[model samples]
Target: MAEDDRSFVDHYAVLGLPSSEEGTKISLEEIKKAYRNQSRIRHPDKRPNDPNATADFQFLTTSFEVLSNETTRSCFDAKLRTRRERVLRDSFQNAKRRKMATDLEQRERSVAVDPSQEVRRKEKMKADELKREIAEFKARRMKKAFEPLNRKDNVEGEKKDSSLDKGRMLKAIWETSAGDYSAAKLRGIFETFGIVEDVVIRTNSLKKKSSAIIVMASKGATVRAIQSMSGDTTNPLLVLPLESIAPSFSSTSSTNQNESMGPEFNNVVGAGFQNYEAFVMKKLQEAYEKNKCM
Candidate 1:
């Protein structure tokens, strides 16, 4: 056998005894017993026809000689332990070298770059950023362009809020020179312009005239009612704001005064009209002319 193979040969395995990579665990007596059994089986004189019997017997005798002595056996066991540890250490070092080489190769491949692809990637990023900026600019421009329209819509919304039930309460007077007007009839007539919250009819028996205090839901409704109803001479309605009436004819006092002094209430209302008569007549005349043209 080769010298390297001879150096790796286990003496306990040669004697047919149980052994491990670390070392054997046999006493001198146990070694002698194992040696005697192996010598009987591997002896040249006992195996006359076997061609390799002499070499096998020599190997067995060498194993027996080494294991039978304490000092030699200790040296052999130490050499076996050192050889096992060396093999393990070499295997670990080889594996670590292979991993480092693989990592270096991967890093080199990762560092290798395509210049055109890099430029394209940067250009794509810039384009995306520019698109985002343009979108933001367009949004700002659109908002600025529509600002006037938005303000107009807000003004219309404010007008609607004031004209509905939420804002100021306005009052108008409805006086008829000839016909008697019921509260329900007046409410029905005035509701065409807007909401009529209330209608209070007052009759003057001596003058044969009827008038009503119309409580409108809002200023817009009151204005619209006055514009539409003021200039009809046959069924005249002196639609005026309650604030335009005399100081004595307040909202609270008007009802009481109308009930107690029926004809005198009309007189007081006429007296209050002196201040606003021209303006009211102009608007009434314009409205009448417009209606007549229609």
Candidate 2:
């Protein structure tokens, strides 16, 4: 291996096979199985444009090639064994030094000192306690001064945070015929607008279809997402604010949410959603009238 690649290229570790310590005896079948599993996880297409992904995938392939064939396998196994032995030897030496250093420190601390030294140590300890008390006093005063400001900000922050609470959450519905509304896909679509806190996919057994509820970080995020994702009828996907959906579907609880979300969740941005829609519609109408005059 080259100097640059040496740090990262561990063939056995990458292949998820037994190390030299485990008496490396991986079968050809095991190697092939491990490669397929790891390749799926590290494939370039799955992680597009990743700077290190291509190199890592190539390294994985190289490891498989070297370890599978008899001639290369012998050479590689010999090098791996030597590397493991060197690592184990270094570890043992490090542990021994650490134990010796700890023993010395304990011995020095346990030994009695002269009277003058003891007096100086007691005085230093007293001084440190006084300094610590003074620091604590100052901290308390600063905290008291900032209390009102923090409380006020927290009230506003809490209102928004509670909406995205695990239980009784506020979310938007995405009704799509795409048949592949994965959480990752939805996150990718909406993340550019704002933070997506969670995505919930529920099967509608009656309709034999699937829809998703997206929980955004804030009302502004929800508005931005709706504007971008559901701006026109020409778009196949129908993005509606949770407040607009029928209560049965929109206000339904997630099976995963066991924790109690307080009554404050009722205040989540329903009115804001309506206002956002009105604003978008007004803009569209204005554009339409202007084009008619033209």
Candidate 3:
């Protein structure tokens, strides 16, 4: 049979099969199975302009020529058997060949390690470590990004995070270094945003300072800010994108809100954003066009 006409072919050398391995004694059924798999992988049509692939395809063609014929298979089997049976008894030749291959591999690995690669890897590691130390920045950005994700418009309408039967809300507490200015400065910070309904920062019994259970005007907005910061603690400077503060929800029917007006109730709190007047108008326009409100 011509090389191209064969369904598949794999030289034992190409497939990493030991030199001793031969197709003569193996069942024809096994060869066909292997051929189907290797043919699809090494087919020239499958690999575009790959020199190794072209060579491999050629070798496979030669392999098929030998394996598919009973007479040719007999010859290959005899040669392979002879080589393996002698390799164990003739240790000197076998050891020398193995040593040469091992030395070549070691030299290749040495060349693979360019000094530039080590420099880049260390630089990346340092940047990541710096970010992890500045945990406060990551938290703030995470809070901002996540706050706006809340589905303010529950399917029924005007649903808040605590209200939804399913869905979660962002709950990130502000972080400040331990100092006289920390608690006061943190309070002033939250006060400036006019978003925090309640914030309690204190030195714990362990003498460690922490902020707990802070409420936000828009939990969704806070979360949006934070997620935008980044999950990779590599760069402290890459704050979350400010534009992510806007909630992504389109509209919701107030009727869908929990009738009980529980934690899910939309509290008419002031957002206190600097561009409040402009922002409110934009939201009003969006709500009007959607025809969500009566």
Best-performing candidate as measured by TM-score: 1
TM-score of each: 0.35, 0.34, 0.26
Please, what are the lDDT tens digits per residue for candidate 1 over residues 1-294? 257656687888888887665246667888898888888888999999999999989999998899888899889888777777877898999999999999999877765754466678899999999999999999999999877767788999989966655222334443345455677877898899888887776666675445567777776776666545554433355555454332231233445534443342343344333335545445656776899899
TM-score of 3: 0.26
Error of 2 at 116 (Å): 10
The candidate with the higher lDDT, 2 or 3, is 2
Candidate 3's residue-wise lDDT over 3-30, tens digit each?
A: 5335433355553343455444566556
- Writing each residue's lDDT as its tens digit, candidate 2 over 1-294 gives 356346745677888887675625778788888999999989888789798889889989998897788888778778777776877898999999999999998767765444467678999999999999999999999989877666778899889976554322234444445456778987887788788788887766567446678878776776666665554545445565564322222233432111122232222233343444455556666776899899
Give candidate 3 regions above 4 Å deviation: 1-10, 13-24, 92-294
- Using TM-score as the yardstick, the better of models 2 and 3 is 2
Candidate 2's C-alpha runs over 4 A off are: 1-8, 112-294
Better of 1 and 3 by TM-score: 1
Which whole-number lDDT from 0 to 100 does residue 293 have in model 3? 57
- Runs of candidate 1 with Cα error greater than 4 angstroms are 1-7, 20-25, 79-224, 230-294
Taken over the whole model, the C-alpha lDDT of each candidate is 0.68, 0.66, 0.51
